[model samples]
Target: MNEYSLLVLATQYSFTAAFAAMAAGTLYFMMERNNLTPEYSPVASLCAMVSLVAAINYFVMKDTVGLDGQAASLAGFATDYRYIDWLITTPLLLAVLPVLLGRSRMNNGMMARLLAVDVLMIVVGYIGEVSINRAGGGTMTGWWCLLISMACWFYILYVLFAEIGRALEGADSYLKSSLGFLRTYLVISWVVYPLGYLIAVLDLSDNLLIGREMVYCIADVIAKVGFGMAAVSVAKRLSAMQWEARS
Candidate 1:
């Protein structure tokens, strides 16, 4: 196979791996959710939903980069697929924060605002990506689109780091430490998406255009599945505590 075909196969297999992980995560979250207290149940459901949505999305994604390692399918829907997945799954993933932090402890309005910004970030980023797609390369419009989206992304970082990370009043040390790692995980995993876009915007390398999809596949698994696993574990602990207190 040629280089393009190899890249396509790599991307395709990466998506398959993501699909398998998410599918497994869904089952795991669903099973373990029953072990949590009712108050902590929402996080489990949200985690499962995030995995379920991405799992289905990745299953379809397996088709977009083309079958048999050809660019036969990446035409109309390819650009929109991931954004749609993000539109649905991102909010759900973020919503888990408020649940984990406890609604009483978190600023509901601020959290709501953060989720709104997250949605806008994805929407505008999608617009920018579509512009790039239509141009078959970078464009001035795409640059501005990405810049605005990055602005939104910075706001999200503020919310995550400043708003949510600022307080942990009733949280145990274990949970506090988990959130710390999760915050860092968000920092590490979430940044890859925009950087992938930057690779395209900068026109860094032709190979990266194909390779970015592989990067995204890896990031999605880490962001969604890895995050879900941690969230569920935390919820399980909290539930056990709640159950013990009741006893």
Candidate 2:
């Protein structure tokens, strides 16, 4: 089969797999929700919501690839389903990090600002994707949207590192370390999306395009399910921090 067909199959199956993973994550988190103390209860719910949203999107995306006649075009991103998925899910995933710290460490203002920036980042990145993917550029052209989105991304990281990390100053080492790892992993996974968009801009070979879609699907699974599971583990640890003393 040709590259377009190959890309569709590869991504379709990948989305199916992510769908299963996310569904499992949602069930797992919901089952564990009631087991946690009130302080950590929202952790499970937040995680479940993330997984559920991702699962639904993956299902829709895979179907779109196979049935909605997804096609590659120099004029526009073929897999814009992924963008729609990211628009909703990215903010929820971002919320996982701060929510783990509870309201005390991440106040309402901070959480709102962080999520707002995340929305801006994704929205602008989508704009960049559409602009650059167009046959001869959409409204804007070439890297402006990409650069602005990158700046927003960097701002979010600044908040995570400088502001949120400050809030984490007195947290247990285990919790802090776990959060650090989760944040890094999620950020790195997120990098794949923009890189794929860049590849589209380069007008790379179909092989590269196929590879990009496959990679994007795999990374989506990791980004969604991995974050939820890791967040659950960290939340439980923090919830039980007082177990020894109380016992």
Candidate 3:
């Protein structure tokens, strides 16, 4: 347990809050445009609010929860259990979101790709959780989680980028304009996790005190900021497409 570790946990929690807020906003916007139905919008909003609440809880209870320790910390608990729980449940919920919200006229290929990616991410997340739990060593388990997470994230990023490109092919002005920013945001934001994992693998933290901090920072940024950006992007695209049909 140390001050640095506490700081790391606090940072992680803050990032989660930021992500949840963004997700809630995205879902709300999509609902307004009829991209997502009212029923599903409430669910998405609830999840987002939960994420923020969990983040706050972690931050507020950090010290009492042994968050300064390497093996037992608030951030560790969230990543090792809570976040994994969400990852597993989210895909199942999402599998039904499209059905409940009804389908858009957008490319089926893109939707299929996203669905596939979500499934893969859930599977990979489970694998990561299992691997880390089994490894049972600080650096060892962390490395295992980092590797699996990076792999899954990279795959997700690829799918998202490819789908956006496909959508841009003959997209209208509004859709294209929105996607241009979305693409850049996704590519850059998603890089944070992998970069952090790479740093961990290289064992560069020995020379750089900031290395450990970077690892937690990247994880938080990717999970929160990256996911938020994605939710917003998808919501925007779907909403705009619906509007185009009406007009």
Candidate that scores best on lDDT: 1
Question: In model 2, where is the ten-residue run with the lowest total lDDT?
Answer: 67-76
Residue 181 lDDT in candidate 1:
77
Q: For candidate 2, report its TM-score.
A: 0.86
Q: Would you give me the overall lDDT of model 2? A: 0.75
- Off-target runs (Cα >4 Å) in candidate 3 are 1-78, 85-105, 125-155, 199-247
Query: Please, what is the whole-model Cα lDDT of each candidate in the order they appear?
Result: 0.82, 0.75, 0.47
Per-candidate TM vs. native?
A: 0.92, 0.86, 0.53
**Each prediction's number of clashing residue pairs:** 0, 2, 0
In the range 1-247, model 3's lDDT, one tens digit per residue, is: 3345545445445445544554454454334434443433443453354345444533443333343324234334333443443454344333322332334424566567666766565555455545544543235555665666666666656655665455456555665665555546545654554454355344553324233443444454354434444554455456556666879
Q: How close is candidate 1 to the true structure, as a TM-score?
A: 0.92
| Candidates ranked, most accurate by lDDT first | 1, 2, 3
Q: Of 1 and 2, which scores higher on lDDT? A: 1
Model 2: per-residue lDDT, tens digit, 83-133? 777888888888878777767777778778888988887787777766766
- Which scores greater on TM-score, model 2 or model 3? 2
The regions of model 1 sitting more than 4 angstroms off are 1-4, 71-77
